[model samples]
Target: MTAPTLFHVAILRTLLIVAALVALESNRLEAAAPEPTQKIASAAAAFLDTLDDTQRGKVSFAFNDAAQRIRWSNLPVSMAEHRGLRMGDLKANQRDAVMNLLATTLSKMGYEKVVGIVESDEVLRKQSPKGAPPFGRDEYFISFLGKPSATEPWMIQFGGHHLALNITIAGEQGVLTPSLIAVQPAKFTLDGKTIRPMGRETDKALELVQALTDEQRKQAILGSQMRDLVLGPGHDGETIQPEGLKTSTLNEAQRKLLLELIAEWSGIIHDTAATAKLNEIKANLADTWFAWSGPLEAGKAYFRIQGPTVIIEYAPQRLGGDVTMHIHSMFRDPTNDYGKKFAGK
Candidate 1:
C-alpha cells in the first residue's frame, strides 16, 4: 500500500477521534441506564440468600404453577385463604431484606404506601371483634412465583388481610395490576398521628364524582349497589361492560379529575411502570367509563373506573354493620395481568 499524504493522514485521524468519542458516549449511556429488571432480580436473589432452606421452601414456587400464581387473597392468613412465607416468620434482618426487595420493585411513594397498608392492618388487629381472623403487620406473606432472573418472567406476591401487591416483571417492563388494598378501622390513631391507608384513593374518587354535573351524575351513578370489587383476587383476566358515564362526554375539568382519580391507583407502582400505565389510560381516555353506587357522600360509597386495559373498584365493607370503617379496592389490567405479555400467553 502507498503511504498516505499529509491531508489523508489528518482526515483519518479526525475520523478515528470521532469514532472514539461516539464509543465513549455510548458506554456512558449504557452504564447510566442499568436495566431495572436486573436490579429487581438482584434484590430478589439477595432476599432469597437470607432465607434458610425451610424458609426458601415456603417462599419459592414454580413460575408456571397457575394455582400458586393466584393463591393470594384479601382475607387474613388465619382464614386459611393464602399460602407463603409469613412476615412474622422472618427475623428482623430478613424482614429488612424483604423491604429492600420491595424498594427495588416499587417507587418511594409506592413503598411507603405498602408499608402504611401493612401497618394499618396492625391497627385493625387491635380493633377486631370477637372471632375475627388474626390481623397484624406480620400476617402478610411474600412469595416468589419463579426463580429470579434478569431476562425471565417472574412475580413477587405479597399480601395479607386488606392488602395484596402482585408485582410481575417481564424484561424491562413491570406490572402492578391485579393488586388489592383495603383497610378496616379505616381511620386510626398511630403514634399520635391519624393514618388512613387508602385515604387518597377514597378522597380523590369522591372529589371526581362530586365534580360531575347533574346530567353527568345521572349517567355515572349505578342503579344498584356495588358491595365489593367485581375483579378482586381470583377474578383475573375478566372484563366488565363499560358502564356509567364515558370520559368522552365529560368536560375537560371533569376529565382531568378522572385522570387524577386513576393515578391514585396507578401511582402505587414504580414510576416507570406507573408512567407507562398512566399513559396507556390517557391514550384510551375517550373509552374510559366511570360508575358510582351507594351514597355519594364522603363517608361511604362504591365506585369503578373501567377502560380498555384498566379496571379500578372501591367498595366499602359492611363489617360490624359500619359501612364507613371498612373498605375493599382493586386495580387490574385485563390484558396484562400476571405479566401475560412477558409470559407470551
Candidate 2:
C-alpha cells in the first residue's frame, strides 16, 4: 500500500474530527435523556410543550380535582363526555406526542395492548348500528390531572370506549390503578397480524384455572354467574369481599402460575414500575384469592384476583351477542388508586 499524500491525510483527519463530533453529540443526547423513572414525566412535559395554551388548558386539571380524577369511563365520549383534549382534534405532531407519552409510560406489551384496544374500537366504528354512538381510535382522549413531575404526584388519564388507563406517578413510583382494559371485538387483525388486546390475560388465567386440582377447582369456582365487571369504570375505591381459593393453598407450581396470571395486569406499566408493583403483589400472594365463574371445559370465563393491594377482574360481556367477542377487565390498587397513599390523600 502507498502512503497517503498530505492532502489525503488532511481529508482523513477532517473526516475523523467530524465522526468524533457526531459521536460526542450522540453521547450528550443519550446522557440528557431521562432515566426510566423520569421518562413518563419527561414525556408528559414534552407533550405539553407541543401544545398551545388553549390546548394545554383543555388537557390539564388541578391535582386536587377529585371529580376529575374519577371522571373516566369505558363508555364512548358520546355517552360519557371526557374532560380532556380529544385525540381526534389533535394535530399530527400533537397526536404523536401524546402517543410518545403513552409509550414512555407503559411497557412494550402494555402499549401494544392499549393500541390494540383502540384499534378494536375503530373496527367497531365501521360496524356500528344505525344511530349508535361513535367508536374509533380517534375517539380516545388524553388528560393530565396535574403538571407532570418526577418527584411529586400527578396523573395521566387516557381512555375511550371500552378502555381506561389511570396511571399515577409519584417520585420514582408509577401506579396503574382503577384502569379499565377492555375491547369490543376482543379479537381482531391489525396490519395483517391477529390481535387480542387481552389475550395473555385470558390465556394465563385459563392456564391457572386449568392447572387446579379437582378439590382446588371446587374451591376456586364461584356459585353465581358473573356477566360483567363489578369494580370497573365508576366503581373506584370499592372492593367486593374476596371469594374463591386462597393462593396460600396453592402448591409451588400453581403459585407460579398465579403470579404469571397476575402479571398480565401488574406488568402493564414500564418495567421499572412493574417490577416494584410485582414485588408487592408477590409479597401479598399468600392473602390473594382467585375465583372463577364460568365454564371449566372451554370458552370464555369471568375470573377475579383480589388481594390486599390489588383487585383484577376479567369479565367477558354476555349481553353483547358473542360473550367472547367483548371483554372488560379492571386493575386497581385498593390502597393506592390515583396514588392516594403516595400523595397522602
lDDT winner among the candidates? Answer: 2
Flag regions of model 2 displaced more than 4 Å: 1-34, 297-299
Q: Model 1: number of clashes?
A: 0
Error of 2 at 63 (Å): 0.4
TM-score of 2: 0.88
Write down the TM-score of every candidate: 0.87, 0.88
Candidate 1: tens digits of C-alpha lDDT, residues 1-345: 988999999999999999999999866654554377778888899999998899999899888888888888888787757777888889998999999999888888788778778887887788778888888988889999888876667889989888888888876678897899788877777799888777887888888888999999999998656557788877877778888999899888988888888887898877888898899999999888999988877548889999888899999988757877788989998888887876764
Q: Model 2, range 139-256, lDDT digits (tens) per residue? A: 9999998788766788899998988898888776788987888888988887899988888887888889989999999999986465478887777767699899998999999998
lDDT of the candidates, in the order given: 0.84, 0.87
Clashing pairs in 2: none
Error of 1 at 183 (Å): 0.9
- Give me the runs in candidate 1 sitting further than 4 Å from their true place: 1-34, 129-131, 224-226
Clashes of each: 0, 0
> Counting only residues 3 or more apart in sequence or on different chains, how many pairs clash (N, Cα, C under 3 Å) in candidate 2?
0
User: Distance from true position, residue 100, model 1, in Å?
Assistant: 1.6
